[model samples]
Target: MLALPAAPAAAGDIRATVRDRDGKPVADAVVVAVPSGGATGAGIPPGLAEEDQRNKEFVPYVLPVQAGTRVHFPNNDNIRHHVYSFSPAKTFELPLYSGTPTSPVLFEKPGVVILGCNIHDWMVGYIYVSESPHFAKTGADGKATLGGLPGGDYTLRVWHPRLEGSEQATARPLAVPATGAVDAATTIGLTPDFRARRAPTPGRGGY
Candidate 1:
C-alpha cells in the first residue's frame, strides 16, 4: 500500500493592500481568505462582539466577524435607537431602547449584514459575516495583515461598504509560501459614499 505525503503545516503571513480606483488607500475594507480545501472559521472561540450606538451613529461603522458569532448592540447615547437590518445575511430588529439588550444577535451565515436605525435614517452600519476565520479589516494605511496562516491555496476576497460591484467579483486565487511572508494587493472601484454626515457629538467612544 502506498502512503501519501503529510500535509504541509500552516506558516507565514499575508499582507494585503487595498486601494480605490484612483489609487487611494481604502480604510475599513474587509479582507477574507477561504482555503481551497475548506477553512474552519478561524477557530474563533464563541464570544461576543459589540456594535455600540453612540452619538446617533454605529461605532466602528464596519465590523467583520466569523460566522456563528454573536454581536451586542449597546446604546450609549442619551437617545433611544431602533436598529434593524434588511440584509439577507441576518435580518432582525431591536426595538427602541436606551441600553444594551439582554441578549446578543447570532450571525450564523456568511454574507454582508447592513444595519440601520429606524429612528435615524441617516444612521448606517455594516456587519460582515465572514465564512472563513481568516479575515482582517484594512486600516487607515489601506493595509491588512493576516498572520500565522498555514501555507496553502486560498481564494482571497475584498469587500467594502461602497464597493461598486459584487464582492465576489473581487476574489482572486492565492498561493501562500510554506515559510516567510507573502504580499498581495487589490484595487477596488468604489461608488461615492452616500452616508449622511452629522455634527460631532460629545461622549463619543470606540467600539
Candidate 2:
C-alpha cells in the first residue's frame, strides 16, 4: 500500500513498556498512539504487513498495521490453509491455498482482527489495525519503541488478545517531545488463553 509523503515537524519517539498486574512483562501487546490533531497516517511509511502460515501456526503471532493498509497471508507450509477473520473491522475468507494469494486483504478500519485457520483450531493470530501509524507490538521483554512521531498531545493505549477488559479502559494521555525519546507505560489484566490445555503432540494435528 502507498503512504502519504508529508514529513512530521520536529519528529520524536515513544519508548514504551507493557506489564501485567503482577508487574511482569507482557508480550504480544500492541501499543497505539492517536494524535490530538493531525492525520495519523500522514508522514508514516508502511512496514511488512504479512502473516505467514508455517510450522502449523501463524508466525509473529501479533501484527500491528496502520488503517487502510493491505495485508498479505502466505502459506509457507507443505499443507494448504484456509485463513479467515470474521472480525467486525474487516471480515473475509481466503480459500485453501499455498504460497501466496493473488492479492492482499485491505484493512480499511481501525480495530482488532482475529485470524484463524479453518483446518487448524490451534492456529490463531491477531491483526491490530490502528487508526494511527504510530504503533508497535511489545517483544519478548515487553518493550517497544515507536519513533518518528512529531511533538504533540496524544492518547496512548495498549491492546492484548487476552486482555481482561476493553482497550479503551487502558487509554491515557501522553505528550510527545519534539526531539529525542520519551517514556510511556501500561499495566494490563489478562484472561486465560482459550486454546486447549494439552501440549503439541504427533499426528493429531491438521494434515
| Candidate number with greatest lDDT | 1
The sequence of per-residue lDDT tens digits that candidate 2 reaches over residues 122-196 is 889899998888898999899999888878889999999999999999999999898988999799999988974
Native-to-model Cα distance after best TM-score fit, residue 58 in candidate 1, in Å: 0.5
Cα displacement (Å) at residue 111, model 1 = 0.6
Clashing pairs in 2: none
lDDT of every model, 2 decimals: 0.88, 0.87
Which regions of candidate 2 are displaced past 4 Å?
1-9, 37-41, 45-48, 197-206
The segments of candidate 1 whose C-alpha lies over 4 angstroms from its true place after superposition are 1-10, 197-207
TM-score of 1: 0.88
Candidate 2, poorest ten consecutive residues by summed lDDT: 196-205
Error of 2 at 128 (Å): 0.7
> Over the stretch 71-161, how does candidate 1's per-residue lDDT look in tens digits?
9999998878889998999999999888899999999999999999867777899999988888899999999998767778888999999
User: How do the predictions measure up, each by TM-score?
Assistant: 0.88, 0.88
